[model samples]
Target: LETVGYTLVVNPKTCVVCMDRPREVAFELCGHFVCCAPCANSLGHGVTPARCPLCRADASHQRVMRRAASLHVATMADDHMHPPPPPPPRPPPPPLPRPPPLRPRARTTSLGPTPPPLPPPRP
Candidate 1:
């Protein structure tokens, strides 16, 4: 259990394969948070999709679950733990420069300059 702002949060579920780390990945089709990222990647190797270990559902794609902040704030006056302030917002990037206008290309004959008119037939 984790304490955040005097509230208790339960994070007791661990990965099914490793049984060590907490379950942080959820199968898209089965909607089960039973495996960690490494375990899921191992199962879903190559072209074959991984099957849900719990429900046997197709788990070709899975998403990682974001854990809640572990910051602990006390209710009484003696507790001094405080989360750091967030950084200031960043400025927007500058706009890109416009490209120059394109000029029209001159039209040419298909036979490539007409072979200089065959030098007047070499009379």
Candidate 2:
């Protein structure tokens, strides 16, 4: 005989507020897994201002419970299904060194030599 195990899956897209996996917690009203604690709190108390995190349905009278089975499944799924977080960014490469400026060439003409003037033309 062969044995197989079944697991519950939580859809992240269904919940708008949860940062972590939705399977970590379960909804009180709809019995559907939605978001984490922060999201649950935002929906108001399960009995008072009750609201569904995913569908925004009225959940004032529903009961909230911690789902151990679902949480276990989520943890296992997380371990095998998720990709490793990206590495931290590296520092930019050092700026390139600038080349030295070229020196001006010396002039060959003598500094004190005077130039010949034009002769006067006949009228």
Residue-level lDDT tens digits of model 2 in 1-123: 123466545444233465443444454434455556556666674455666655555545443434565665344334433333456799999999998999999878777878799799989
Q: Over all chains combined, what TM-score does candidate 1 have?
A: 0.43
**Model 1 per-residue lDDT tens digits across residues 16-110:** 67777777776666566677788988885777768877666777778777534311111110131232245579999999999999999988768
Residue 5, model 1: lDDT of 100
Tell me the spans in candidate 2 whose CA falls farther than 4 Å from its real position. Answer: 1-15, 45-48, 61-68, 71-123
lDDT of 2 at 64: 40
Worst lDDT run of 10 residues, candidate 1, spans 69-78
Instruction: Go through the candidates in order and give each one's C-alpha lDDT.
Output: 0.63, 0.52
Largest TM-score belongs to which candidate? Answer: 1
Clashing residue pairs, backbone N/CA/C < 3 A, model 1: none
- Candidate 1 Cα deviation (angstroms), residue 15: 0.4
